[model samples]
Target chain A: MNKPLAAIAAFAGLVFLGSGAWMLAGHFRAQDAVLVEIVQDGKVLYTVDLASEEDRSIRIEGADSWNLVTVRGGEIFMEEAGCPDQTCVKMGVLRAENLPIVCLPNKLVIRFADSQEVS
Target chain B: MKLTTRRLTELALLTAAALIIFVIELRIPDLVPIPGVKLGLANIITVYAVFRYKPEETALIVLCRILLGSMFAGRPSAILYSAAGAALCLIGMLAVRRFIPPKWIWLCSVLGAIFHNTGQILAAMVLMKTAVIVSYIPVLLFTGCIAGAFTGLCAQMLVARIDRKPPA
Candidate 1:
């Protein structure tokens, strides 16, 4: 194999290994309270404690679209969206710290809040 | 960039082909729920163009594809993410092409994918004004590598088959 090709292969291998480990760490990380924040256009619209919050839905209106965030059974997921691609809705639930349910068109993000951010 | 008529026509044709691919791929169901995870099949044309044309010419094709693609998809907000990703991907591929032979085009494509994901994360960070999105980088990179290899292999095969000269 050529040197450049070998180098590229090595780089990709390292990236895969590193990223795989990172994601696994996120997955296996311990949890305290399941606090999630609903943010639109960088503003915190709502923060709900899934552990105690009742089953309810929040509607977020963006500049050009909308999203329905729902919490049920102590899980937060996108229930509906006005955007063409329902990627956020399909994400199912917010689990990993690294992976946030995102709706780009609506500029909405549903993610677990860092414990420090809680007050 | 001095564009001969033939070069201009080829660029236009490639742009159209990329737009069509972009629109068609939109019909495919989400392979994963993540926002940035995609096959990015339109990038096959991009990879082919990066190897076949000058950097500026390749850039033009990519720009045209993104602009027209978002319009057709009716998702104007997506244009920002796509444009940033394409720009970084193009620059990375173009720079790395010198080190990579045509036979190993997939390597360049993988690098491009990494750059593309980085650009997406950067755009998301700026737009969302939160570094929390940085956490998605690992997942995006993992997926980008796989998708990039597939599209790269497709481009490599096209490079092998197509003659550089236009048929008159």
Candidate 2:
């Protein structure tokens, strides 16, 4: 009811609504995009066409950690990680455009490329 | 700032308590796959200390906790991200403290969480050197708000209870 409380509430509301909308848009827009990139330490290690790539696994080694990136049946997922948290492995699959599969400890990122970037 | 023996002891105790909470929270399975998302239960102490102690004192406790916590977790690599998030969160909460009375400490906590998320994302971008990392901003912000509110509300209840008790 107080002014500051009201302001805080309004600010949180805006963030919640805006983020929710952005995430939704990102998810919907992610469909039909097949190009996925595997990046580590800011460098692109591999850029594969998921829709056309063969079912194979790529082992990416970082400075102190490693990740097993697998593409199966046209879907990409982190099969394993040397890091303890295993967050990237649990990310299941690279689904949303805005949500990349990340392993902070290993400094690895697996994300879908922008559709425009597709050749 | 003159830190009397009693003040020093109090800060040390708060830091230890926060470190314990941080370690315990690590045991909890990741609620989501995102790198920066968590309950951040240790921040409850930070929120309580922000309102109860001087800004410099609160900063000391947080810094100590982050250093010790990284060692305990055996994830030295994560120290950078944790430090970035904690520093931004502390500064933001300290500045916002003036507007929020004890009753609304949760609001300050929420704002602090936002700052913490921003710091983590920025650190990730710089360290990863990838513009694609920007895509994570929305999800991290969304989760940060929830985690921040939870920790803030816990700290608010803690403050209420501690204030009700007469100083011994």
Candidate 3:
């Protein structure tokens, strides 16, 4: 009912709306994300050009854990993991530029790492 | 802060209710694979307690729920993230309570949620020592607002309908 509080609420609401929209738009427009990187413990263990690299599975070992990352047909995803919560496996695939398939327990991540970003 | 029998009972009830919602939520299956994303339906109790009870009482209830929830769920690692989020959420709501009246409870809830997610992001950043995780904040912010609004309304309704001190 108060003006300042209402203004604060309106400002916050707009900020979230704008950020959500921008993130989503970027996600969709990132179809050119061809370079995929498999990062573990903040380190890139492998970088693959989905277009040129042959289909393969990379087994990432993490402090007494395992995550099987798969790359095929210009896409990468967590095929499976030894972690109790199969959150990464359920992520399906690494499609968006910002969104990444992550297995926290295993400390693994599969994300779109644009060619230049790949290390 | 005297621990009256009634206050003790209320705190216990609130903690139990939150834990139940948390456990049941675990069974609902992850709506998304992204870490730190959840409906957090249990937050309704925290939001309600923050408004209805003393600040310390609200903190106790939230602490008990976080500790016991993780213990029962057998995920000690989760305790870290949950604690961080709940602590920030509690602090944010309590501080903002002075400015926002009961009628604008939803705004307070949204603010609390934003703080909660920010806390989680900070925890993840510290633990992993990576900035890549920051990208998840926007998504969390978006979902946090919607979920916060729903739980906030639920709390507001309960507060309006139930008297803190029932006729003895």
> Highest lDDT, which number?
1
Q: Which stretches of candidate 3 lie over 4 Å from their true place?
A: A114-119, B165-168
Tens digits of lDDT, candidate 2, B1-168: 889898899889989889889989989999887788889999999999988888888899998998899888877888899899889999988876778877778888988999998899888888888877788889888889889999999999999888743222
What's the DockQ for every one of the candidates?
A: 0.71, 0.69, 0.57
Q: What tens-digit string does per-residue lDDT give for candidate 3 at B1-70? A: 7898977997999999999999998889987667888888899999888778889999999999999998
Looking at candidate 1, what is the lDDT of residue B64?
92
Task: Give the alpha-carbon lDDT of every model.
Answer: 0.87, 0.86, 0.81
What DockQ results for candidate 2?
0.69
Least accurate 10 contiguous residues by lDDT in model 1 chain A: A110-119
Per-model TM against the reference: 0.94, 0.93, 0.91
Candidate 2's TM-score reads 0.93
Candidate 1 chain B: 10-residue stretch with minimal lDDT: B159-168
- Candidate 2: where is the Cα deviation over 4 Å? A1-5, A116-119, B164-168
- On the 0 to 100 scale, the lDDT of residue B45 in model 2 is 95
Which residue pairs overlap in candidate 3's backbone?
none
